[model samples]
Target: MKLVVGLGNPDREYRDTYHNIGFNAVDILAARLDAPAFAYDKKSNAELADVALGGKVLLCKPQTYMNLSGDSVGYLSRYYKIDMRDIIVLYDDIDIAKGVVRARLDGSAGTHNGMRDIVSKLGGTGFARVRIGTGFKPNYMSLADYVLSHFSSGERDLLKAACEAACDFTEKWIKGEDWQELTVTVAR
Candidate 1:
């Protein structure tokens, strides 16, 4: 089984924040797949849906909040008996340029506490991941405050488009498209 985990805070207040782009991307994927709406899974402490993405696919949004996201991801991984390599995590990255999406097999957590927690819980950094760029936090703005800020009306359009492009790349990956031939760049 394939697992895709989206990292973000669960509270309603964080729904549209830049840091919650991971959640937004997951929602877009679910909508595109025409899967049932995500429902809270108490056992997993996450919002979840199982859809057919060329096969069985488990989509999850950990409700444990961002920093402690590993708690939920670890639970689902152990419970489902899924191999670490089959798991794909989606999260925002401030270091990457705005309107870009990157995919990698494995990497360090960088400055993302959520990813750091996941690496700690899972005992390593072997899982696949997609890092959606939210752009660097402006010099005048603190990283935490900027990540929690809501996107502007104009920026919303760009983010929405980015989500779609990211979803397309994910779908292609799922369908066995050659990874080396894949290219997804959204900068509008």
Candidate 2:
């Protein structure tokens, strides 16, 4: 079985924040599949849903918040006996442009604290990743404030489109498509 993890904080206030793009993307994907709605799992501390592609795939949205995301991830992964290689994490990337997504088979956490904790807890970086771009941080803004802030009305369209693209990217990925063959970045 493959696991797709969408990293995000859980709460109504965080619903539309740039940091919650992961959750947004996962919700899109789940809807596309008409998969069961996400339900909170006490053991995983995450919202869980299952969809079938090549096999049963678990869609996870970590509810431990962004920084402590590893706690939920580690628990689920261990419980599922999922291999590191079969895990895919989707989250926001500040360094890339808003319409772009960077895919990789393995890598460092970079600047995402959630990813950092995930890598640290998992003890490896062999998992796949789909970094949904949130654009670069402005010189005048603090990273925390920026990520937690809502997008402009104009940017909302871009984000919604990006979320769709991310779902497509994820579906193709879990269906065994070649990573390099997928659209690395899709821009309007």
Candidate 3:
């Protein structure tokens, strides 16, 4: 089984925020695969769905919230007996340019608190991460406010494209393609 987690705050208020890019990507993936509706699972503290692809069961989770994401991820990971290598995390990256996607096999959380919490609970950064760039916010706005803010009209179109690209790269990654090749293909 492969576990694909999208990190985001789960609330109506966070629906279209920059921090919810992960959720956006997962939605695209689910739509592409015609996956079933996501229902909230109390035990996992996430909206969960399941689908089969490439002979492996794919478990999707849009965690409860960014700060408490590890709770759901750890729960699902343990329940499914999935190894770190079979896990993929998708989230927004402020450092990269908008409309771009980056994939990494394993790495520190960098500046993302959600990733940090996941690493802490999982005991390591041995899983894969797909980062969809949201672009940097202006210095005038606090990081919290910036991340929770909605994307501008112009940014929305770019974000939509980026989300689709992220989903495509995710499918490739799950299929055991080279990380570099996936990145290069999405970067094009």
Candidate 4:
């Protein structure tokens, strides 16, 4: 079985925020794949949707917020006995330009607190990752405030396209296709 996890806060207020891009990506993928509605699981503290993508795949949206995302990921991974190599995480990256989607097979978490926590819990960085860019934070705003802010109307379309591209990238990963060097950048 393969696991695809999206990292974000669980609050309604975070629905369209920059930090919630991971959740947005998974939602789009689920819809495109005709996956069933996500059901909340108390033990995992996440919303899960099982979909068949080349095989049995579990799409997860962790509800432990950004900083503590590792709790849900670790529990679910251990419970499912999923290999670290078969796991993939999707999340937002402020360092890249907005509307860009990038994939990496294995690496350190960098500056994302959610990814950092997940890495810490998993005790390894062998899993894959897909990052949706939310653009760099402005010099005037704090990182926390910027990440929590919602995307502008103009950027919304770009984000939607980016999410779709992320879904394609994820599909490639699930199918064991070449996805390591793929980078998708939406037109402005």
Which tens-of-lDDT digit does each residue in 67-129 have in candidate 2?
Answer: 999998899889999999889998999988998877788889999999999999899999988
Q: Write the per-residue lDDT of candidate 3 for residues 101-142, one digit (tens) a residue.
A: 888889889999999989988889999999998889889999
Candidate 2 TM-score, true structure as reference: 0.95
Q: Each prediction's Cα lDDT score?
A: 0.86, 0.89, 0.84, 0.93
Q: Using TM-score, give the best candidate's number.
A: 4
Residue 137 of model 4: what lDDT? 92
Runs of candidate 2 with Cα error greater than 4 angstroms are 181-183
Q: Residue 100 in candidate 2 has what lDDT? A: 84
Each candidate structure's TM-score, on Cα atoms with residue i matched to residue i, is: 0.94, 0.95, 0.93, 0.98
Q: How many residue pairs collide in each prediction? A: 0, 0, 0, 0
Which ten residues in a row are the worst by lDDT in model 3? Answer: 179-188
lDDT of 1 by residue, 1-188 (tens): 88888888999999889899999999999998988989999998999999987889999999998999999999988998888878888888898877888887778999999999999998898887788888999999999999999888888888888778777767766665656323356868
- Which residue segments of model 1 deviate by more than 4 Å? 180-183
User: Against the true structure, candidate 1 has what lDDT?
Assistant: 0.86
On TM-score, who's better, 2 or 3? 2
What does candidate 4 score on TM?
0.98
Error (Å) of candidate 3 at residue 6 is 0.8
